[model samples]
Target: MEAVVFDGNKLKLSYEKNYPKPEILDDDDVIVEVHYAGICGTDLHIIHGEFPAIKTKPIALGHESSGVIHAVGKNSVYKVGQKVAIDPNKACNLCDFCHKGNYQYCLTAGINSTIGIWKDGGWAQYVRVPQQQIFALPDEITTEQAGLCEPYSCVSHGFNRASPLKVGERILVLGAGIIGNLWITTLHHHGHREVTVSEMNLTRLDIVKRLETGYRLVTPDVLAKENTTYDVIIDCTGVGKVMEISFNYLREGGKYVLFGCCPPAHTTSLNPFQIYNKELTIIGVKINPFSFPSAISWLKAMGSRYVDYHKLGVKTYALSEYADAMEDLKKGSVAKAVFKVVKD
Candidate 1:
C-alpha cells in the first residue's frame, strides 16, 4: 500500500510506495478503502512540530476522510461496499467523561484511541477503523463532501461554543482559510449575513469574494486602519499575534471563539482590564464531541441543497500530488485540499 508517513523520530513527512497494509486487530474492526482524504492545517502544524498531543509517529497523516468499507468484522452490523465518513477520534464508553455524555473529553482518547493523530489513519489506500467510528454516508452527499466531515464537525462544535449567537450579530472571522470559510458558510446557513472576513492573503480574499456570500472582505491593513468593532469575533488564524490583537475587534459583551490550533508552546499577553470592562467571553474548542451527526446534517442540507461546498474552494488532487497539495495550502491558494486516493 502507498501512504504518506510521518517519520517517527523526525519532523518529516514522506510519500512511500510500499507501506504496510493495515490488519484488523479486533473482532469488530473494519477496513475502509479510502477515497478522499483532506489535508488539514493541523497536518502542517504536526509536520512543523508545532501541534501537541501527538502520541505516535510514522503514522498516516489524514484524519479527515471518506471512503467505503473494504472489509468488515464478523460481529459488525455494517457491510462491505457501504460509503462512509471517518471520525478519527474514538472515545471509550466506559470513561468518566463518557458517563457524563461528554465523550470528547474521554480520558482514554488522549493517546492511541484517536486514529490519524496517534495511530495509523487515512493517508493510505486502506485504513483500519473501529466499527464505532465509522459514519455511514447518505446518497444525497458526495464523497468529496464527506471528506470534510471532521473539520465541519469541529467548526460546528466551535460555533456552538460561542452561544447566544444571533442572526444579525456583527461577526468577524479573523482568517480566510478553510476553517474560516466554513465558519462563514455555517453562519450564513444559519441566517447570519454581512460577516467581516479579514485576511492578509489576496488570493484567499479573492476566493471568498467570488463565492458572493454577501460577506465584507478586507485586508489586515484595511482592518487596522478602520478599527471597526464587531459584536462577535472568531479567531481562526491561531497565530499568537493575531490572537492577541483580535481582542480589540470585539465589542462589549461579545464572544471570542478560538477555533484554530495554535502552537502548544505559544503564549501571548492580553489586557485583563479590557476583558473585565468589555465583559467578553473567550471560548476554546478542543475537538468535535457529539457534533459528527450535526456535520452530516449540514453536509446534506448545506452541501446538497443550500451551498455548493466545492465553490468554497475545496479541491481534490491525485494521491501522487501530495507536494502540490502542501504547496497550495501553504500559499493560501486553496480553501481546502484533498487527496483523491480512489477513483470514486
Candidate 2:
C-alpha cells in the first residue's frame, strides 16, 4: 500500500509506494479501505516537525478520512462494504475522565494515542481502526462528503463547547481555512445569519462570499476598524497574535471559544482588568469526542444546499500528487485539500 509517511527522526515526509498495510490486531477492530482523506493543518504541522510525532516511529499522516470497510472484525457490528468515516481520537475507556463521560480528556491523549498523529492513520490504502471510532454513513452522504465528517465533527465540538449560544447571536470566526469555514457554515446552518469571518487570503474571502449566510468578510488589516463586537467569538487561526487580539472582539458578556491549536511556547499579554470589567468567558475545545454522529447527519441535511464543497474551495488530489495539493493549500489557492486515495 502506498502511503504518505512522516519520518519524525528525519523531519521529512515522503511518498512510499510499498508502505506496510495495516492489519487488525484487536477483535473489535476493522480495516477500512480509504477512499478520500483530507489534509488537515495538523498534517502540515507533522510535515514541518512542529507537532510532537516522536510519540512513535514514522507513521502514515492523515486522519480526516472516509472509506469502505474492507475487512471486518468478529465483535464489530459493521460488515465489509459499509461506508464510514473515522473519528481518529481513540479514548481509553478505563481513564477517570472516561468514567466521568469526558472522553476528550482521556489519559491517552498525552501519550499520542490519536490516529495519524502518533499511530498509522488513513493516508494509506487501508487503516485498522477500532469499531468505536467508525461511523457508518447514511445513504444521503457520498463517501467524498464523509471524508469531511471528521473535520466537521471537530468544528461541531467547538461550537457545542460554547454552551447557551442562541441561534441569532452575533458570531465571529477568525481564519478562513478548513476549520474557520466549517465554523462559519455550522453557525449559518443554525440560523446565525449575521456572522463575520476574518481572513487574509483573498481567494478564501471570495469563496466565503459565496456562502448564503452573512457577508461580513474582512481582512485582518481592516478587522479592528470594523468596530464590531460579537456575542461569541471563535478563534480558528491558531496564530498567537490573532488569538491574543480576538479577546477584544467579545461583547461584555460574550464567550470566546479558543478552538485553534496555537504553538505550545507562544505567549500573549493579558489584560486582567478588561476581563474583569467585561465578565467574558473563555473556553477551550479539543478533539471530536462524540460529535461524528451529529456531524454526519448535519452533512447529510446540508449537503450541496448549505455545505457546498466547491464553494468552500475544497479540491481532491491523488495521493501521489501531495506536493501539488500542499502547494495550493500553502498558496491560499484552496480552503481545504484532500487526497483522492482511490479513484472515483
Candidate 3:
C-alpha cells in the first residue's frame, strides 16, 4: 500500500509505494480502507518538529479521515464495508479523567494518544484502529464530508466549553481557516446572528463573503483601529502575537476561547491585573471529547447547502500529490486541503 510517512529527520513527508498493510491486532480492532484524509495544521507542526514529545518517527500522518471498513475483528461491533469517520482520539478507560467523562484529558492516554500522532494513521490506503474510535456515517453524509468530522468535532467541543452564547451578544472569531469557518457555520446553525470574523488573508475573507453567511469581515489592522469589542472572542490563529492581542477585543466578564494549537515552545505574556479586574474567563480547548456524535447530528441537520458553503476554497488531491497539497497549504492558497485516497 502507498503511504505518506514522516521519518522525523526531515521537514517533509515521504511517499512510499510499498508500505505494509495494517492487520487487526486485537479482538476490538478494525481495518479501514481510507477514502479521504484531511491535511491539518497540526500535521504541519509535526513535520516541522514542533511536537517532539508526542510524535513517533516513521508514522503515517493523518487523523481527520473517512473510510470504509475493510475488515473487522470478531469482537468488533462494526461490520465489513461500513462507512465511518475516524475520531482519532483514544483514552485509557481506567484513567481518572475518563471516569469523569473528560477523556481528552485522560492521564495515561489523551491528545498524544491520537491515531496519526502517536500511531500509524490514515494517510494511506488502509489504517487499523480500535472499534470504539469509528463512528458510522449517515447515508446523507458523503465520504468527503465525513473527512471533516474530526475537525468539526473539535470545534463542537470548544463551543461546549464556551457555552451559553446569549441572545444579542456579539461574537468574534479571529481567523478564517477551516476551524474558524466551521465555528461560524455552527454558530449560525444554532441561531447566533451577531458574528464577526477577523482575517488577514483577503482570499479567505472573500470566500467567507461569497458564502453570504452574514458575518462581518475585517482585516486585523482595521479591527484594531476601530476600537470594537466583542462579548465573546475566539482565537483560532494559534499565533502568539494574535493570542496576546485578542484580549483587547474581549469585553469585561467575557469569555476568550483558545481553539487553535500553538507551538509548544511559543509563549505569550498576559496581564494578571487585567484578568483580575475584568473577571474574564480564559478557556483552553484541547480536542474532541464525546462530541463526535453531536457534530455528526449537527452536520446532518445543516444539510448539504451549509456543508457546501464550508467546502468552498477546499481543494482535494490524490495521495501522489501530497507534496503539492502541502505546498498549497503552506502558501495559504487553499482554505482546506484533503487527500483523496480512494475514488469514492
Candidate 4:
C-alpha cells in the first residue's frame, strides 16, 4: 500500500510505494479501505514538530477520513462493505474521565490516544481501527462528505462549549480555514444569521463569497478598525497574537471560544483585571467528545441544503500528490484538502 510517512523531522517526510498494510490487531478491530482522507491543521502541526508528545517517527498522517469496511474481527458488530466515518480518538475505558463519560479527557488516552498522531492512520489505502471508532454513514452522505465527519464533530464539540447562542446574538469567527468555515456553516445551520468571518487569505475569502452563505467576510485589517463588538467571538486561528488581539472585539460579558490549537508551549497574555471586571468567559474545546453522532445526524439532516459539502472548498488530491497537497495547504490556497485514496 502506498502511504505518506513522516519521520519526525519535517524534511524527512516522503511518499512510499510499498508501505506495509495494516492488519486487525484485536478482536474488536476492523480494517477499513480508506476512500477519502482530509488533511488537518494538526497534521500540519505534526509536520512542523509542534506536537512533540504525539509525534512518532515513520507514521502515516491523517485522522479525518471516510471509508468502507474491508474486514472486521469476529467480535466486531460492523460488517464488511459498510460505509463509515471515523472518530480517531480511542479512549481507555478504565480512566477516571472515561468512567465519568468524559472520554475526551481520559487521563491515559487523552494525550497520546489519537489515530494519526500516535499510531498509523488514514493517509493510506487501508487503516485498521477499533470498531468503537467507526460511525456508519447515511446513504445520502457521499464518501467525500463523510471524510469531513471528524472536523464537523470538532465544530460540534466547540459549539457545545459555547452553547446557548441567543436568538439574535452577533457572532464573529476569526480565521477562514477548514475549521473556521465549518463553524460558519454550522452556525448558519443553527439559524444564526448575524455572523462575521475575518480572514486574511483572499482565496479563502473568495471561497466563502461563492458559498453565498450570507456571512460578512472581511480582512483582519478591516476587522481591526471596526468599533462593533460581538457577543461571542471564536478564534479559529491558533496564533497567540491574533488571540490576544481578539479580546478587544468581545462584548463585556461575552464568551471567547478558543477553537484553534495553538502550539503547546505558546502563551497569550490576558489581563486578569479585565477578566474580573468584564465577567468574561474563556471556553476551551479539546477534541470531539461524543459529538460524532450529532455531527453525522446534522449532516444527514442538512443534506446539502444548509451545508453543501461540495462547496466547502475541498480540493482533492491523490495519495501520490501528498507533497503538493501539503504545499497548497501551507500556502492557504485551499480551505480543505483531501486525499482521494480510493476512487468512489
Candidate 5:
C-alpha cells in the first residue's frame, strides 16, 4: 500500500515497507480503506509549526476523511464494505466530559490524523478507526460529499451552540471562506434571509457572488461606514482586528460567535463600554460534540437545495500531488483542498 507520509513538515509518498494492512485493533476498532481526505487550515498551521507541538517526524496526516469498512472488529456493529464518514476525534468514553456527552471536551479526546500532523491519518489506502467514531453516509451522498461531513459537523456544532436564531434577524458573518460560507448556508437553511457576510478579498467575494443567493458580500471599508446593525455577528476571520471591527456592527444585546480559530497566543481588544452598556451575548465554539448525526440528517434533508455538496469546495489533486495541492491552497486558488486516495 502507498501512503502520503509527512516527515519533518514535508510531505512525500512512500511505499509501506513491511507496514501491515490496517486491521481491527480492538473490539470497538474497524479498519477502513480510505477513499478521500480533505485538507484544512489546521493542516497548514501544523506544517508551518503554528499549532501545538505535534508528531515531529514521519507520520500519516489526514483527519477529515471518508471511506469504506475494510474490516470490522469482533464486537463492532459496522459491516464490511459499508460506506462511512470518519470522525477524527477519538475520546475516552470513561472520562468525565465524555460521560456527560461532551466528548469534544474530554481530556483524552484526540485523533490519529493520518497523512496529517499527528497520528497516521487517512492520506493512505487504509486507516484504523474506532467504530464509534464512524457515521454511515446516506445513499445520496457521494464520497466527496461524505468527506465534507467532517467540516459540516463543525458548522453544525456552531449552529447548535448559537440556537434560537430569531426570524428576520440580520446576521453578519465576517470572512467569506469555507467557515463563513457554511454559516451563510446554515443560516439560510434555518430561515434567516437577512444574513450578510463581510470579506475583504475581491476574489473570495466573487466566489460568493457566483453562488447567486441573498448573501450580501461587503468589504471592510463598506462595513465601517454602513450604519446597519446586526442581531448576530459571527467572527469567522480569525483575525483580532477583524473581530474588533465587527463588534461595532452588533446591535445592542446582539449575539457574537467566535467561529474561527485564532492563533494560540493571539489576543483581540473589545470596548468595555459596549459590553457594559449594550450587554452583548458573546459565545465561542471550539469543536463538535454529537454534531455528526445532526449534520448528516440536515444534509440528507437539504440534499442539493441548500448545498451543492459536490461543489462546496475545490478538489485539485491526485494522491501524489500533495505539494501542488498545498501550494494552491496557500496561493488562495482553492477553498477546501482535497486529496484523492481511492477512485470510483
Candidate 6:
C-alpha cells in the first residue's frame, strides 16, 4: 500500500517495501481502507522535528482519519465495508484512566489512538485499528464530514472542560483559524450573547467577521480598551503573548481557557498580582473524551444546515501533494488542510 512515511530526516510519499498488509494483530482489531485523512497542525510539528520525544523514525502520520472497514478479526462486532470514523487514541483499558473512560490519558498511549502520529497512520490506503476505537459513521455524514470528527472533538472537549457558558456571557477566541473559528461557533450555538475573536491576519479576520454572529473584532489596541474584559476567554492561537493577553480579557470571576498547544518547553511571564486580585481560573485541556461523539451529534443536528466546511474551515489537497499541504499550514493559509486519499 502507498503510505506517507516519516523517517525523521524526510517525509515522502513512498510505497512501503514489503508493506505489512492488514492482518489480525489482535482478535479485537479491524482492518480499514483509509478514504480520507486530515493533515493537522500537530502533524506539521512532527514533520519539523518539534516532537522528538514522542516519535522516533519511519511512521505513518495522520490522526484525523475516516474510512470503511475492509475486514474484521474474530469476536468483532463490525462488518466488512462498514463506514467508520476511527478514534486514533488507543488506551490501555486496564489502566485507571482508561477504566474511567479517560483513555486519551492512558499509560500505554499509542497513536494519539491508532493511525497517524505514534503509529503507521491513515495517510495510507490501509490501516489496522482496534475495534474499540471505531465509531460507525451516521448515514447522513459523508466521508468528508467524518474527516472533521476528530478536530471538532478536540474543540468540543475544550468547551466541555470549560463548561456552563452563561447565556449572556461574552467570549474572546484568539486565532481565527479552524479551532478558533469552531470555538466561536460553539459558543454561539450554546447561546452565548456577545462573542469576540482576535486574529492578527486581516484575511482570516475578514472571513471570520463575515460570519457575523454579532461577534466583535479586537485588534491589540482594541483589546487594550481600559477596563474592558470578557466573561470567558479562549486562547486558540497558542502564542505565549496571546495567552498573556487572553488573561487580561477575563473579568474578575471569568474563566480563561487555553485550547492551543504552546511549545512544551516554552514559558510566559505574567503579573501574579492580576491573577490573584481577579481570581482568574486558568484551565487547560488535552485531547477529546466524549468530545468526538458530541461534535458529530452537534454537526448532524445542523444537517444540510451547511457551514461551508471546505471553504473557511477546509482546503483540499491530493495525497501526493503532501508538501503543498504542509506549506499551506506553515504559511497559516488554511483553516484546515486535508489530503484527500482515494479521491473520487
Off by over 4 Å in 2: 109-111
Any runs in candidate 6 off by more than 4 Å, and if so which? 9-21, 52-56, 110-114, 209-212, 225-227, 304-307
lDDT of each candidate versus the true structure:
0.84, 0.84, 0.86, 0.86, 0.75, 0.75
lDDT of 6 by residue, 1-344 (tens): 66777775564334354555667889888988888888776776666666532345577677888889998989799999888887787666687887888876775764344457667778887888889889888888887778777877888888888987778887778888877877777776677758778877766776675555777876666677657788888888767777766677788888889888776665677778988999988888777776668978866765433345644557877777777877777777777787677658
Candidate 2 has a TM-score of 0.96
What's the TM-score of each model vs. the native? Answer: 0.95, 0.96, 0.96, 0.96, 0.91, 0.90
TM-score computed on alpha carbons, candidate 6: 0.90
Model 5: CA > 4 A from native: 8-21, 110-117, 309-311
Write out the backbone clash pairs for model 4: none
The per-candidate count of clashes, in order, stands at 0, 0, 0, 0, 13, 8
Over 1-344, each residue of candidate 1 has an lDDT whose tens digit, in order, gives 98988875688778888999988788899999999898888888878888753545488888888999999888887999999998988667787888787777777773236687878888899999989889998898777788888899998888778877898889999999888888878888888985899999988888787566889898888878885899988889988788887778888998888888888887878898999999988898888887889999998988643345556777778767888988888878888788889974
TM-score, candidate 5, is: 0.91
Model 4 TM-score? Answer: 0.96
Q: Point out the worst 10-residue segment of candidate 6 by lDDT.
A: 302-311
Worst 10 residues of 2 by lDDT: 106-115
Tens digits of per-residue lDDT for model 2, 256-278: 89888876666777688888999
2 or 5: which has the higher TM-score? 2
Question: Global CA lDDT of candidate 3, please?
Answer: 0.86
lDDT of 3 by residue, 160-252 (tens): 899987867899999988778888888888888899999999888887775567889998998888878889999999887897888878778
State the displacement of the C-alpha of residue 102, model 5, in Å, after optimal TM-score superposition: 2.0
Q: Which TM-score value belongs to model 1? A: 0.95
- Tell me how far the alpha carbon of residue 267 in candidate 3 is from the true structure, in angstroms, after superposition: 1.3
